[model samples]
Target: MSESAAPGALEQVRTFLNTWWVPNDTRAPEDRLPALLADPAAWQADLPAFAFPGREDAPGMAELRAALRAALGEARPVALGPWLARHPLRAELSADPDRPPLALVPEDGTAGGTILAAVAEAVRAGQWARLKACPDCSWVFYDHSRNGSRRWCVMNPGGSESRGCGSIAKVKAYRERRRITS
Candidate 1:
């Protein structure tokens, strides 16, 4: 329960998806995902928060978050029935090897597997998108680019082309310049 402990497996997976794709201010280290999966209960108290900015009241989301946190903490993947009962997203996972495992895809897709597969393919072809955290929110996301030089969180409306931390410095410089001129 301590804040510094690693998150459980389900929480790790959820955190990876929620942060890696959508980008958030509260993402854990990328390596934490596999580590937590190897040991679900290795960290219980520090699991990432699952609440999205605009979807806190969505039906079943809270329960789903709790269930995923608990299940990933287990020694093994919990049965599908119980997991699905708490979160319908489990239904999107199929037995097809061609698809990505249910754990990888977002709910907006028909099946998580397909999206997962695409991510893998993109990664293998050296086409995997680079991601950067939001300077303000710390959200993670794939940076779609040929040169892969993106540095801002696309999910945030306020995100500027200038790097988050760098933008602050620019503002300070502008004010100092104006002060000297005046």
Candidate 2:
């Protein structure tokens, strides 16, 4: 897949969580995520609110991300209990008033909340185990294969420079193999 294609919600949240280690300063590991999200005008429709909290006090974003990354890397199903309390969703009533309540939505409206919600949704759909990171680039992507064994981001050979990690790693492996063989 080309880099231009936007990721699905599950991948979007995973990518967002991966940015916890990065601060929006020099754009090294990644751009200033918090700052970008702060721009309401920039947020595309259908995405969760961009105003996620992270300042002097930590919002558990990093820890949550680390735990998720570790579990995904190990190809295991993560128990959602520890995070449920902190990122609780508000129960919503149905419009008809005669029907049951609608699905719960995040109370805080922060990106972290959105991401966590996505994880919960994925789990319920039996798709959480398919959300994974590219070992070469740490970029999160969904494994759409029948066996759910896909690795590497969906990008092809000419993927943008910002996403050259997979290509670079492939080249390195090729060279190492050639050296060992010769």
Which candidate gets the maximum lDDT versus the true structure? 2
Residue 123 miss distance in model 1 (angstroms): 3.3
Stretches off by above 4 angstroms in model 1 are: 1-122, 154-173, 176-182
Clashing pairs in model 1, backbone N/Cα/C closer than 3 A: 10-72, 23-139, 23-140, 24-138, 24-139, 24-140, 25-137, 25-138, 25-139, 100-113
**Winner by TM-score:** 2
Name the lDDT value of residue 1 in candidate 2. 50
Q: How close is candidate 1 to the true structure, as a TM-score?
A: 0.28
User: Which digits, one per residue and each the tens of the lDDT, describe model 2 over residues 1-182?
Assistant: 53322234565665555553322233346533455456545434323433435452144655666667776634334555576677777766677765345545677765566667666656655777776777665666667778877777644554233555557677889999999999
The lDDT, on a scale of 0 to 1, for candidate 1 is: 0.37
- In Å, residue 154's CA in model 2 sits off its true spot by 3.9
Per-candidate local distance difference test: 0.37, 0.58
Model 1, span 1-182: residue lDDT tens: 42111223322333444422222243343333334334435323333322221233233333443343233222232443453332233234578897545544434432222323333333334433343334443444344546766554442234343235436545777999999999
